[model samples]
Target: MTQREKAKQPIEADVVVVGGGPAGINAAIAAGRLGARTVLIERYGFVGGMSTAALVYPWMTFHTVEGKQVIGGIADELVRRLQAIGASPGHVRDTVGFVNTITPYHPEVYKTLAVDMLHEAGVKLIAHSFVDSVAMEGDRIAAVRLTSKSGRLEVRGKVFVDTSGDADLAYLSGAPTLQGRDEDGRTQPMTMKFRMRGVDLAKVKQYMLDNPDEFYRKTPIDELESLPLSGVMGFFKQWNAAQLPINRDQVLFFTGPEPDEVLVNTTRVQGLDGTDVEDLTEAEHLGRKQAQQVADFMIRELPGFERASLSQVGAQIGIRETRRIVGRYTLEAADVVEGRRFDDVIARSGYPIDIHDPSGKGVAASWVKGDGAYDIPYRCLLPQRVNNLLVGGRCISTSHEALATTRLTPSCMATGQAAGAAAALAAEQGLAPGELDVRLLQEALRAEGALLV
Candidate 1:
């Protein structure tokens, strides 16, 4: 049921973080800042994972509905850096109220910024390298083998942080993992983001500023004007009237940092496993087809996009859910919907529970109560049977429902920062990550400016 390969040429680190998404970046930075010898491995040449590779712009839910900025630390640093370069427009409300406070940014610049921060933190980065396998010693992982054009190499670490969104390392290391919903193994549909240039934002705004009733985006609330998904329903109605074979009902668009460009998030591919190579390949092909088709549809049906051209397609399809590691504690849907708080919380989450239908039709969400947030406990990051291992991103222990919230970019940054700090402390004290003092870890996090309340 599997394949195998022999590993060679060992390298070592105090902490080894797999995957270079927001989580891995923060983890590496935290460990390095703590004076730990950290190594970060990424499959892509660039650092940003879904944010860059999948073109998933706009960091979401940086604050609670009550408008308290809950996430800080390296995540804040990134936002500030992007702000300094005028590549970010700052956090604002979601037009449709699907989430709160989405900070839209330039993908390429974000990648470069992440790399610069990582390097400045003294974290060694190995790009274009994929984790092949994990070497285990009883309940602990000894090292993980990586493959690249350079050749096969094994990286030994005192502690391992798995930020792979698909939970690749957790699955490989014999940690228990679950996929999708409990009733069935069906995951949320995957989306491929594409961009269009020569967009008339003024025209779109004028249309929205006039025909407010026909558009999906309602009027700006609380004096916060987010990037608009205007003229969505009206254009879909037009698509229907014109007998266009447009399969989607929602119009998801983000205003880019650069004028005249709009990022589109409408390509949805269902019935695919993000972790399976064959399924991923099929999804990619289907995604490409849809990107072209949608670009053509937008030009014909939507205003502002009348003269728009397909400028770029994301390098990879963005799969929202895959394998979720069964960790020491599993975050449940109720915990999020009810805004559960934990004494051991290392990160605060204000995001709602968003589940995109597996059939790729639409999305359903349930928000937290009283405009407050929930806490992600340290237990969720601790994978069962892996004492020295910590899961940092979407793969951290969560039910299919809870992963919907925890998988957001902001949550990933918080979890990643926590995992890296825990790993570094564990390595320094010669203790497993699970056995490290969480109180001390919290103090360290507070000292680093993480907003945990």
Candidate 2:
């Protein structure tokens, strides 16, 4: 800790991406592929932020409402590689006539794949690095200060992508942000996902069919009673009619992973601010205890769990919503519900508006049927009042109601790629992200195999 060291200058790069989640990973990779000296800083040791570390397995929608694969480039390549390794299967047809793509891979697989991709792409990765503050020059982000094992350091970049999910970099850089809803800004409940081993697939399916209401009733849980698994039977019937296999005892239920085995998603703990370290720590403590209670109940009450064993629990609690950067154009619920299209659209999302209540007893979801896809304008990815900064993932600008749908991983990936590509192009050509030609950016994205409409 010499005086010279204390005053050392920050490392500089062409593009710097904070947060190593799906959005950040894709953004960094895209920037690097476009020949930018990209640097990706992550708080955790590994990449794939939520999907791998938090164990949010199974990417939701990769296709448009018409069942055509709309996501490509690194995102699709990763999925294809994982599928080749048997980490995931093909898409599952849902009762609502949508294909739900689930990747039931070990979380470690995602970590490995993500690292391999980043290494091959030549992006410098600094792990165990937590971004603390943003150094700004008026509307432009100058540098980002990070705390790591080595010491506190600063990373300066020409272009910065705020993929921190909570809009940490953007918020600190003086960009306006919206957190949760209302003055208190309450976020959705966080869940701990775990998996169960030796689940009798047959018995689980049967319980859903034969005892729909009773099965949900006897689940021995209160926070999820409002979710009503009994109603899922109708969905199962649709699957059965479509010639999908219906197993009775094999219930991959969402009871929240607990102990050593079950993936629990039932902790309804709320009122904790994800950006606050103390609040997050307390939430983790309560979440772990609640996970244990869920596991115990599943083993004792659920029919297919007579001999089922808990296999693994999530490494991190799955956070649903957080700080959203106020972008140039905030997508709203009306836009999503009406299936609006945009000429400047860079990506589209078809997932439902699934908003988990803070109380954790019920979930609010709006499902769309038949060609109900909404365009994500490029403006939503650009943070307002920032010249060289952009945002993606759950933190992108959108109305509170619209965020319920746009926060999914696939949508995050699409926007991440767009933002990354946009940043690289802007830096390479000495233009601000907002100043870049939309048609040129779109051309570059399409050249990189991104699906844009």
lDDT of each: 0.85, 0.74
Once superposed on the true structure, which residue ranges of model 2 sit more than 4 Å away at CA?
A: 1-9, 64-66, 94-99, 212-262
Most accurate candidate by TM-score: 1
lDDT per residue as tens, model 1, 32-65 = 9999999999999898899889988778879987
Tens digit of lDDT per residue, candidate 2, span 161-211? 999899998888888999887656888877666666765544654655554
Let me know the TM-score candidate 2 reaches against the reference structure: 0.86
* Root-mean-square deviation per candidate: 3.7, 7.1
Model 1 shows how many backbone clashes?
A: 0
Worst 10 residues of 1 by lDDT: 224-233
- Minimum summed lDDT over a 10-residue window in model 2 is located at 226-235
